[model samples]
Target: MEIERKLLKRSSLERLVDMMRSDGNMIYAPQKKETQVVFDTIETFADMTEDYIVSNQSPKFVAFPKIEKILDFSISQEGIRQEGTQLAAFPPVVVLGCRPCDADGFDSLTAIFNWDYKDELYNERLKRTTLISISCAQKDDYCFCTSVKGHPGSTRGSDILLTRFDGGDYLAEIVTEKGKALTEKYAALFEADPGIEKDKFLAEVKPRFEVEGLVQKCMGMFEHPVWIEQSLRCIGCGACAYVCPTCACFDIQDEAAVSKGERIRCWDSCGFGLFTIHTSGHNPREVQSQRWRQRVLHKFSYMPERLGVIGCVGCGRCSRACPVDMNLSEHLINIAEV
Candidate 1:
C-alpha cells in the first residue's frame, strides 16, 4: 500500500500521546537517565527528551525482555504440571522516538525467533507493539546506520515515521496500516500534507563499507588472524552484545524450589567466556579470538545465509558501550579491505 503523508504539529503530537495513553497503550519514549538517554515508559509526552542523538538502549526490550519467565511447573506425587506464559494478556505497546536503525534491528530478531519454530511470546508482543520512529536530525562519529542498508530516516520497521522540520513541525509518513489506523483514530491531531522534504532534515550517515563485501570476506575468514588482532583488547565483558539491537543469543535456566519451579530465558552473549562451556569442562570458544570470530560471522556471514537478513543494523550502540574501545565499524571496514 502507498504511504499516506500528513503534517503534525508539536502540540498535536503531545495530544496524540495522551490519546494513546487513554486508549490503554503503554508508551515507551526516550528519557534522560542520569548521564545517558534511554527508552523508558512515559506517562506523558513531556517525559521524552529531545536532546539526544540516540537512546543508550534499543527499544527491543519492549518485545524481547532481558529476562522473561517462559513457564512455571509444580511437582506432585501423581505427576507434574506446567503452565506457559499467557501471550493474549500482553498489553498493546508503542515505542516512540526510536531511530530507523533501531527499528530495522527487529527484522533480524524476528527472523531468529521464527527461524524453524514459531515463538508465540515474541510474536504476540511484536504484534501488539507499534513503532513510531523519529528521524535523526544529527549524528555522532559512532553512528553508521547507512553502512548496513539503513538511513537516518528510513521507515523499514516503523508504523509511523516522523521527521522534524526546521520550524518544529513534523512531516509524518504513515508507512504501515498500523500507522494509518493510529492517524485515523486521532485525525484531529494531524493536518494535511505540508509536502516537506524529509531528506534535508535527516542526518547524513555516509556508508563506511559495502555490507556485501564485508559479508563475503567474513564468510571465508573463519581461521583468519585478524579476529585475534581485533579482539586483543577485549575483556569479554559482553557489553557489546547486551547493548546491540540484533544480537539475540540467550541462556535458558530452570529455577526450582521444593514443589515448584520456573523456566526463564535471559539474554546472553557470544563474547562471554562461559557462553560455550560444556558440562565436561570443554569450551569450543575458549579464547576471546574464537568468540570474536563467532560474533562477526554470526552477524555478517551465518545469519544472512540462513535467515536472508543481516544480523546488524549498524546502530553503533555496541561501539559506544564497549569498555575496551572495540569499534565494530572500523573492524568491519578493515575486513572488507582484506
Candidate 2:
C-alpha cells in the first residue's frame, strides 16, 4: 500500500491516546521510573515522558514476555492430563513512542521463533499488537542504530511513524494497514498532510562500521584473542542480554507442588556460564571469554547465516545496562578494525 502522510497536532495525540484506550487497546508508553525511562502501562497521554532518547527496556516483553506460562498439567489416579496456553486470549496492545530501533527488533525475534518451529503463542500476541513509533531527534554516544541498517526515521516495523516538527506537531506516516485503520477510526484527529521533510527533523546517527564487513570479520575471529581481552572484566551477570532487544535465548521449566504444575518459558542468555552446560557435567563454553564470544558470534555470524537476520538491533540498551562499562558498539568497531 502507498504510504499516507498526515499532520497530527499535539492535542490530537492526547486525544488519540484517549480514543485508543476507550476502544479497549492497552497502551504502552515510555514513562519516567525514578532515574530510568521505561515502557509501562499508561492510563493517559499525560503519563508519558517526552524527554527520553530511548526506553531503558524494549517493548519486546509485550509479545515475548520475560516469563510466561506455556502449558498446565495435572496427574490424577486415572491418568495424566495436559492443557496448552490459549493463544487467542492475548490482548490487543499498542506500543506508543518506541524508537525505530526498538520497533525493528521484532523482526529478529520473529525470525528466531519461526525458524524450524512455529511459536503460535508469540505470533498471536504480535498479530494483536500495533506499534506507534516516534522518530529520534537526539541521541547519546551509546546509540548505533545506523551501523545496523537502521535510521532515526526508519519505518521498517512501525505501524505508524511519527516525526515531531519544531512546532511540536507530528508528521504522521501511516506505514501499515494497522496504522491506516487507526487513522481511519480517528479521522477527526488526523489532518491533511503538511508536506514536511521527515529527515530534517531526525537525529544524525553516524554509521560506526559497515555491517557486512563486520559480519565477515567476525566469521574469522572465532579463535582470535580479542574475545579474551574484551571479556576480562565481564562478571557473567547477563545484564546485556536482559536489556537487549533481540536476544531470544530462553529456558523452560516446570513449577509444581505434587500433581499439578505449569510449564514456563523464561529469558536466558549466552553470557551466562551455565548456558551451554551438558548433561555429562561438561560445558562447551567453560570460560567467560568463550561465552562472550558466543554472544557476539551468535548475533553477527550464526543468526545471519541460519535465520537471515542479525540478532542485534543496535539499540544500545545492553551497553548502558552493563555494570562493567562494556560498550558493545566500541567493541564491534575494534573488532572490525582488527
lDDT of 2: 0.93
For residues 18-59, write the lDDT of model 2, one tens digit per residue.
Answer: 989999999999999999999999999999998999899889
Ten-residue region with minimum lDDT total, candidate 2 = 305-314
Model 2 clashing residue pairs (backbone): none
What lDDT would each prediction earn against the true structure? 0.92, 0.93
Candidate 1 CA-lDDT value: 0.92
Could you give me the TM-score of model 2 versus the true structure?
Answer: 0.98
Highest lDDT: which candidate?
A: 2
